[model samples]
Target: MIQKSIFYTSILLIVVFISSGFKPYDNQIDKWFDLDNTDEALYIFPSQKNTDYTYLNAPFKGKFFVGYKEAIGFKESQNKYRKVNTLGYMGKYQFGAETLKSIGISDSLHFLNNPRLQEKAFVTLLSRNKFILQDYINKYEGKVISNIKITESGILAAAHLGGAGSVIKFFKSNGERRVKDEYGTSVRSYLKEFAGYETKNIPAIKNAKI
Candidate 1:
């Protein structure tokens, strides 16, 4: 009688546990490669995209890569070739000195003075950032959270404002932990503001340099 009672109790517990619907927590970490990428977590772009697609009227250019960069340029420095912000960020795209050096641009003056080099620097940074955030893109792209649609272009633009880490945090929190710059700009804003541009073509190159 005792053995039968214990067996019935065991069966009852098992059924209750199975019906609870308990499962493992899902996150980006489980989806990434198994490598100690701590050093890569520190890296950090953008134009301020508002309702100003008419900033260029080059026949559907607003939706292309060209329009995307220009809108960002206008937002950064109002399209000024030699713009240097009070915070010491340089050029039309408002690149910080350290970030410029990461892409092989050391001479701050030369970078500010050369429009071609600055343009090259912008694209190179985009390619590298896209590479770093590729997995995030793969996971979050087309998923709407907080009523905002996610896309590769928006991911890169947000990474431009904050680093890839901030973006990862945003996704890990399911869009709850939005980081911000001193200018009161949030990562989520960039993600939403710059969505649906032609940045899918930017090559995902590791260590991309100008």
Candidate 2:
């Protein structure tokens, strides 16, 4: 009786092992272990079906052009699409009436309401300013003035704050001229604060249209 019971127990263990081997293949945990070259074996490839939030997860601005634009926009109006300041600067980058018109936007109401147009205006203005200040940028882009490093992005930001003319004047005076807006935000401050960002992707075009 003991020998028969032992023999039955051995048969049951063998059957259980074989059944486990025949079960469905579960790649849930092992799928991560599957390596590939596209994702460099680090993570699963992003598929439209399952992948969401492919944006760069960083919170603060980096050295990229997108980060540069978003950072300037945040400072201008906290990235508000329809924000209008007390001085009547419109949209995300806070363009004045004349500034809007300079970019071929005559309808202030349309510019104030249209976010896409406002964004285009910002980039277009950058291109225009870059063209206007090409001489100054070429002259003092890498130089240090008043303990502040002069850069293309800085010059463009200052131009946005005041104007391309102000940026040129500041550079011409060797950083001596301390021009300020109605709110007392100095061109020098914008130059220092917005220094060192990627803005070379914007081509220098005279009379850049929206």
Candidate 3:
């Protein structure tokens, strides 16, 4: 009887191992894995589907208390503090070297490695944009451009994506002139996506820098 029980247990273990090695093809299994409810007994393989809930749900669907700057950081680099894009944009906010220098961050390596500095740089750049685009914000806020409502935070976010100059052209053209980065992400897209955030704490300082 003992020998028979051992033989059965070994066979069951082998079966489980073989089953776990095979990839799951069923869509329901894929969905179960996608939801992240891991079950060892289910033997479901991991799915490569994107897990970013933001994409799965409505735009700007997240915690109400999430700061706009942090949200932009998430969008820019998925909030990876040490991330560097192919074009050499660095840090959580994806600051170009020139922009980093403008904000008093001269060391790209140090800036990329330092999360706090990157956050400060974002605030500084936003402050600078807010100062530079104050008149535009006052004039354009609450105005509709291409069916999207304009807001101060939106303008600042667009300025962060392209530049204050590009944002100005965008506004001056009444949404007729669209500006996109090398990746083809448009300034209007940033404005529209990042709108409706409370950024009043970022005080506008003339020529703001870290």
Candidate 4:
């Protein structure tokens, strides 16, 4: 009788536990990989799409290999080049030759100035994209950028250029190597005023116009 009672109690507890949908470990870790990477998350040009279409636009050079599993699971980057896995993975996100071929070089650039290159890239993107400004802002407001240049030091950003009635803010790094504001103020302060957020790293270069 005692054994039967214990067995029934155990069964009842198990049923209750199952029915409760109780996860002993909160799935906080699952969110480490932001599965839904929006267009904003995409800062690298000559991306997979560009590479895939390289046949039409030959001489492409920006081919990033993005598998469904890895892309969905990317967490944070280590220093700059490597997107360190919060779960399990290693190595920098590799770009392919075809991808590189799709991106046309900036003939107008003479040097690789980060801010200047960033401005150029953003301007080009804005001019070519079919989406509205508001939609672009909403999607890309806080996303980081990466891999548009030849090296790990190639990160760039498109910050809000402040104007009348615009509450937008930008942020600059608060260190000795920080940039300057349009008004000659520290870039850190200027960006903060405009609520500018961080984006991925890209190489800043200046090329002469072709």
How accurate locally, in lDDT, is each candidate? 0.83, 0.86, 0.83, 0.30
Candidate 2 residue lDDT tens string, 1-210: 999999999999999998888855433322455455554334444444434545643347687888888888888898888998999997889999988877898999888888888889999999999999998889898899989999999999999999988887887788898889999999999999889999999999999988
Tell me the lDDT of candidate 4.
0.30
lDDT order, best first, reads 2, 3, 1, 4
Clashing pairs in 3: none
Provide C-alpha RMSD values for all models, in order. 24.6, 9.7, 8.0, 21.9
The C-alpha TM-scores of every prediction are 0.70, 0.71, 0.72, 0.16
Worst 10 residues of 2 by lDDT: 25-34
Tens-digit per-residue lDDT, 1-210, candidate 4: 999999999999999999899655432222333446642332322333444453631222232312211221221122123332343222222212221122343322221223343334333332322122333344444454221111111111122222201212221221234444344434334223223222222222232111
- Over 125-172, each residue of candidate 1 has an lDDT whose tens digit, in order, gives 999898898998998899997778999988998888777788888999
Q: Which of the numbered candidates is closest to the native, going by highest lDDT?
A: 2
After superposing all C-alphas onto the true structure, candidate 1 shows an RMSD in angstroms of 24.6
- At residue 154, candidate 2 shows an lDDT of 95
Q: Model 3 off-target regions past 4 Å?
A: 1-66
